[model samples]
Target: MPAPRLVPDLVPDLVLDLALTVRHDGKGGIADDLDGVDGLARWVAARGDELAEAGAPLGDFVADEDALTAVRALRQAVRTLFARAVRPAPPSPADAQRLLPGAEALDRLAAAAARVPVAPRLTWPESAAPEITYVPTASGPPADLLLAALARAATLFLASDDRTRLRACHAPRCVRYFLKEHPRQEWCKPSCGNRARVARHHDRHRVESAL
Candidate 1:
């Protein structure tokens, strides 16, 4: 059988998309899509237009070790926030504090969040009439812009009612997180759902044989 492609679906929100970067395989192994500087670059490139629409473009990405490190740290922080928020209990003050460790980080995120423009404006496509579009106004190194975009996404996600629907895939070898668009949706994708069902079937057979 062919391997399944890990295509990025157009998630309802950016924060949920970011959380999908690091996934746990149902079999106890973990995979980080943004593993290093190159990985980070690729991830950004893949989402270039999306980020641009959100007012953060990757045209100035540094692709250095330091930049990669910063991005990874921020990714982990965002993941931490999501993990805690989705728990049955409400997130505590300490939980929120962990996301914004120091004054500097907090300021950076705040600044980035502030950079998002108020509204999308009209733009004319070649040979077409003007259409409303979000032109990126945020400026800085790519990493900074990326972080700011992430910060903004995190803020919006945590503040919205839809945050309650954020869920991590329950399949044993799957590590993806997804927004539960429908009440019955369980896994990140159909493959994960099939894998989970197969595992359950095997377990049931094993128990029956033992009995």
Candidate 2:
């Protein structure tokens, strides 16, 4: 199994989770979680249970190499878009264009949405299982369904109030982004905070030693 996430609670949106597929090492380099099809498959599997609960299961769809490539591209676009959005200044025209969903992407989402099924259920007893449940039969290509789900996540995230709190980690060489839950929260997790503090301490000592 892939290693458990270092900061599980930081992922508030699926789009943000997708963007985190690539992370920075704080040593002036970055790491790619979805390095290839296998890497992508692992990433998807890691979230399989959560997706299933959300009514969007992968169901062997991650085996497609082309789908992996497409997902990677979408992740990069989401990162670029959010990076621009969180900056103090307004995003340039080119950046906005990169952020906007293209016609092809929009068409794919529309087609997939049309085929997606809706399952509703009602619980009879509060403590026991639901007396009546409807499990919708899934339709459409799995790859397309995955793409459409990501597109929807991106759209929903953009419209949410949490967008205002979205932030990229400030630690040296750390490229992870997160939704700021607290006003003072900066780094994505405690480890990043410690790393940043150590880097700062080293910088201060080096400057003092030079003097």
Candidate 3:
């Protein structure tokens, strides 16, 4: 089989993407894309445009040890809340035991979102429709700003109707949370569905042999 594709851009929610940084490694183990400072920098760069749109522009952002630690903390909180949102469903097994309490996660997200001041600004091009975008008002540490924007995104997603569509991918070894784009959507992707079917087939085969 081809490698399990862990695409960060698979979802529109920045918070969901951040949580998905932890995923299946295709070897019966979990992988963390932000395992180190370098990995954190790469992750930030990959989401530069989206971050900028969300009012936390970190152009050419460089990740230091502190940045990596802070971002990872925020990610932990986000994942905790994500697990809560998909209640009655199993969360990704990667940090299943390490999730923060629901109340604590809410506090963390609120605090992180307040790290930088932001205000909604409206703009319109000559031939385009008017739109509003949140823009940071003051300067702060790159990590702090990024965390604020990401937390805000999480806040909005959790409070919006879209939260109902979020589901944890329970396919074997798939440590991912995905937005249920359609009614029939089960796993995070088609590949995960294939893996799940194969695993079920093997289980049935074993049961038949036992009989």
Candidate 4:
């Protein structure tokens, strides 16, 4: 079984899922799912349907070292922006001093997004409301197209009201950002919440024993 996640995998935003690729391993260490080209390919494959639905198809896509590098860089920017969005609240430990400055992150995201020029297409079904979708208007390498799509997703998420719901998980060893799904929601998941409570209990016990 997969380890519990602070954020659900079904989040509508790809960038959030991308940012969560870096998470706390169950054994008390940071784990990166996209630590290599193969890992990146796997991650892409897992999200193929969602990416296609979002207007970036990756049919038979294979990731190279360059693609890994590009996606890693974009992930850094997205994570940094996520940290910023949860301002006043502490950011994930993963971002401590490694995050890009806000301005630099913004520039990087914009550059990646501009790599592929896209045009909006309208679609409406008989009983469904009309939706505007952006599709690439220029040819580019699969990596470039994927990067642009991720950057655009990040851009849209940052501009949406959902951004206000972003929060970094504060449970020990957790380095995830989750959307605040409820007014009483604290940690990213129940396990994190339990860990936090247990930690607090231990601290109080220690303090009482010391006194």
Q: Per-residue alpha-carbon lDDT of model 3 for 44-147, expressed as tens digits? A: 88888888777787974679998888888888998998888898887878877889988899898899989998887777679976655567889998888888
- lDDT for each of the candidates? 0.64, 0.62, 0.82, 0.85
Supply candidate 2's per-residue lDDT for 129: 45
TM-scores for all predictions: 0.70, 0.69, 0.88, 0.92
Off by over 4 Å in 2: 1-11, 25-28, 53-55, 89-138
Expressed as tens digits, the lDDT of each residue in 1-211 for candidate 1 is 3221111222245766676777664457666777888887788888888777666767777678877776676665666666666687333222344455445444554665564443456666798755543444645666666776677666555555666887767675665666788989977789889988999999999999999
Question: Of the pair 1 and 4, which is ahead by lDDT?
Answer: 4
Report clash pairs, candidate 3: none
Alpha carbon lDDT of residue 119, candidate 4? Answer: 82
Give the clash count for each candidate. Answer: 6, 2, 0, 0
Best candidate according to TM-score:
4
RMSD of 2: 7.5
Candidate 3 residues lying further than 4 Å off, grouped into runs, are: 1-11, 123-131
As a TM-score, model 3 comes out at 0.88
For model 4, the superposed segments whose C-alpha errors exceed 4 Å read 1-12
TM-score of 1: 0.70
lDDT of 1 at 113: 57
Model 1 off-target regions past 4 Å?
A: 1-12, 24-28, 89-138
Please tell me which predicted candidate would have the highest lDDT against the true structure.
Answer: 4
